[model samples]
Target: MYVAAKGGEKAIANAHRFLAEKRRGNPQLPEMSVEQIREQLGLAVDRVMAEGSLYDRNLAALAVKQAQGDLVEAAFLLRAYRTTLPRFSPSPVVDTGSMRVLRRISAAYKDLPGGQVLGPTYDYSHRLLDFSLMEPEAFAANVVYLVDKMIALPSRIPRLTEIVGSDDLVETPQEEPDQDPPVPDITEEPLEFPASRSARLQALARGDEGFLLGLAYSAQRGFGFQGHPFVGEIRMGYVPVEVELPGEDVKVRIGSILVTECTMLSRAEETGGCPFGFVQGYGLVFGANERKAMAMALVDRALRSRELGEEVRYPAQDEEYVLRHCDNVESSGFVQHLKLPHYVDFQAELVHVRRRDVKKSQGADDQGPSSVGSAGEG
Candidate 1:
């Protein structure tokens, strides 16, 4: 028989109140506004949006405030809120090649057609902390950007993959000529093992940044494919999202959203009289999350072991392992559930341990006197 513990309702309510109070510390200080979070803590907001699978910047900022800056909690809140929204229509696939060029770079080539533009990156910045940020004016002054002249960028930037493919040095991504399959939505259906490329990409898009980064590092450290990978191109900009109306021949542009896209190329084995060429792995995520996009591309390539005829010896290469464990919501729930009261379960385990110990004690007593007497006689 088991008994359950009771009387936590009031305590739980009080705990939530306490949390809220702590979250809004130093009430004398100006309250942090959602707009400030969206604009100032923009990177954090971007991460929450990417991991939550929600694209609303304002909502993500609100979640960040509500969660007291805990990114995982913020993402969880956003994901919960996303479920309540009504589904209207599915958006058409975005075209990355047509993205309004903000930042574009390619490690594979010296200079691409549009030229490498290093726009607003911390890549070469000094690591020393600037304590002057304690003053609001100093922070504002540091971030001021003055564009003296307006220069027209090319309408379209040619992809490095196309450049490499032109000389037959790399295999360009191509769809089957006879069939055009609709991409499966992971949110609509439960993720199955041996998931489609669409499902895999969806999972990687929302996966925890640190987890994906670690796996990508592991793959690079020889746990998986050891091919030298070159970042073909990384682009960050806004692209128009379009949706097709039911029973309509036309698709209308809904809006524009910022995104980061990465294309990674690796050497592929030459066979069947074909020249040695490169294979590509692609990643795209909301906002300017370069690390996430790069990690995603690496993991995406690692997960394609079966299709690419490579041995699946690494954890990243296992489709079931990656997809099943990548969701932050599911992982965080299981981990945080440890805080829930487990009195009944613990009590049952305690009783079982006591009973087993008593039996052991009784058996020891039964053999004790005879063993002691035999030892004394010897």
Candidate 2:
């Protein structure tokens, strides 16, 4: 039975049905709404949105349900669905400076222009499980808040890069090293090494949360955290994406997207023949995942030096190392699906090993009874 070819078609159907049944256990009980999952199980949805690069809480909730609460699988579902949606023109470059922040914190400064706002986060929540929620709630409750909008930002829109650009005090870029960038399509194109910073980030934006976190942790644990990453700022909110139209001269707001952007500081280091300069580590993910984004930023910076002719000495410093490992769909599918039949290759290996053993034994026999004193390692 184990050697027989899999009835893959039937097995797939049966497995799918089993999964659906498990997702909706006890159909007789009142159906759980997507909104309930979105509101109650928000952290899962947040991770999915962060990794999937979409902010539709409803779709994320459904994905979680379909994935049976497996965050990685849920992220994959969201990513698949997001890819299927039509692409509108990008909204005008929504400035992070102008973000309506849901959560904002800065390790750089305790008090900055925008006083840190820890808008919505579970980081402060205790991990203890609650058992009383098995029973239904009597009623929904409302929360209160004080409203203040963009009070920290200057009304006059100043160049953001200009403010930070001068701090380097070294050989500077002729201009913004990253200008109007051409975005790459990850779903359609195979990931290539020495990918542009933009492509690297897009891949990270859609990478697995656990995977990214692990890579980030490895670096911090002495794998490659040579340059201690300082969280310049971790801001979570929506940014407008602008796209030019066929006949329009002015770029218009195509749509808004939630993104977590991280900027890491690297000390000046001379590489190859170039003089030292402040290396900027940047990371951008779909939603509010500051940790993942921050980790991605570190990895991104590490990868950049390779293309810049800097010698790579650390695993995390290698672009291929981080980007190749962060993709869960590719890794998980490839690993788990190995359980499927590949007996042909195994049989060939088995036959080759047996023949080699037989030949070795014959070689021993050729030595005659003297082999009793000349035993050899296989």
* Predicted candidate 2, C-alpha RMSD: 4.6
Give per-residue lDDT, candidate 2, residue 159.
21
For residues 81-172, write the lDDT of model 1, one tens digit per residue.
88899888888778877788789999888767788998879999998887887898878877757465536677777666555546667767
Model 2: per-residue Cα lDDT over 1-378, one tens digit each: 012245779887998799789888899998778889888887778788877667788899999888888987787788778878887555554577666566667675566455667877777889887554454452223333445553454332222232444554422335645566667777678888768777788887777767667777776676664556667667777777778885778776756777777777665445444344555677777665777788787777666666556667777777787788778776876677668777898999999999999999999788887566656431
Pairs in steric clash, model 1 = none
The ten-residue window of minimal lDDT in model 1 covers: 267-276
Off by over 4 Å in 1: 1-7, 147-150, 166-168, 175-179, 269-276, 351-378
Error of 2 at 107 (Å): 1.1
